[model samples]
Structure formats: structure tokens, C-alpha cells
Target: MAKSPYPVINPGGGPMGKVIIALVLIAIVTLVIKYPSDAARWVHGLGSVIDGLVDFFRTLFG
Candidate 1:
């Protein structure tokens, strides 16, 4: 068998990764709780953008 040349490194490999993820989750939850309407609007706008892109591609190919 032959060995590959590259070495693998994991970014989120330890307790620090868990801490970072938890902090991010906390921040997102805080934002949603503090500004529910704004978060909803942002999500709606993202969906609209995705829908528009899909429609554009469908029209272009069809």
C-alpha cells in the first residue's frame, strides 16, 4: 500500500472548539430573542434570494 503525502489537521479538535461553538450558539439565541422581527425578516430575505436564483436558473435552462 502507498501512503498519501498530505497530513490532516482538524480545526475544531478539542474543548476550545466546543466552547467556541457554544458561544456562537449563545450569540445567535441572544440576537433572536432580542430582535425576533429582525431575525425573521433576515431569514425571509435569504429565502427570497434563494428562490430568485432558482427561478433564474430554471428559466435560463428551460
Candidate 2:
């Protein structure tokens, strides 16, 4: 079998799986290029949500 670029993504997986992932990555990159501001807002929103969750868990346990 061919060596994968990132083994963690598809451990013991095949070339077909890699091709599908590459296509999905390409699509995402295209989307980000088309809508950079929207993507930035989305990523920032996700970071804030994750931060809120961490703070909540810390207050609950700490």
C-alpha cells in the first residue's frame, strides 16, 4: 500500500479514502477562499464556544 501523508486521519485506510479526504479539503479551501470573512467569523465563534465550555467545566470542577 502507498504511504499516507497523515496517518492519523486514516489509519489502515486505502487510497480511495485519501482521495475523498483530499477532495473534501479542496472544497473547504475553495469555500474559505471565496468567503474569507465568513470563515473567520465561524472559526472565531467556534473558538469562543469552546472557551466558554472550558470555563464552565473549570468552574464546575475547580
Using all chains and alpha carbons, the TM-scores for the candidates as numbered come to 0.66, 0.69
Off by over 4 Å in 2: 1-12
What overall lDDT goes with each candidate model? 0.91, 0.89
Model 2 has how many clashing residue pairs? 0
Q: Which candidate leads the pack in TM-score?
A: 2
- The digit string of per-residue lDDT tens for model 1 on 19-44 reads 88899999989989999999999999
Residue 23 alpha-carbon offset, candidate 1, angstroms: 1.2
* Runs off by more than 4 Å, candidate 1: 1-12
Report the lDDT of model 2 for residue 10.
53
Per-residue alpha-carbon lDDT of candidate 2 for residues 1-62, written as tens digits (9 for 90 to 100): 98878747555378988888899999889889999999899999999999999999999999
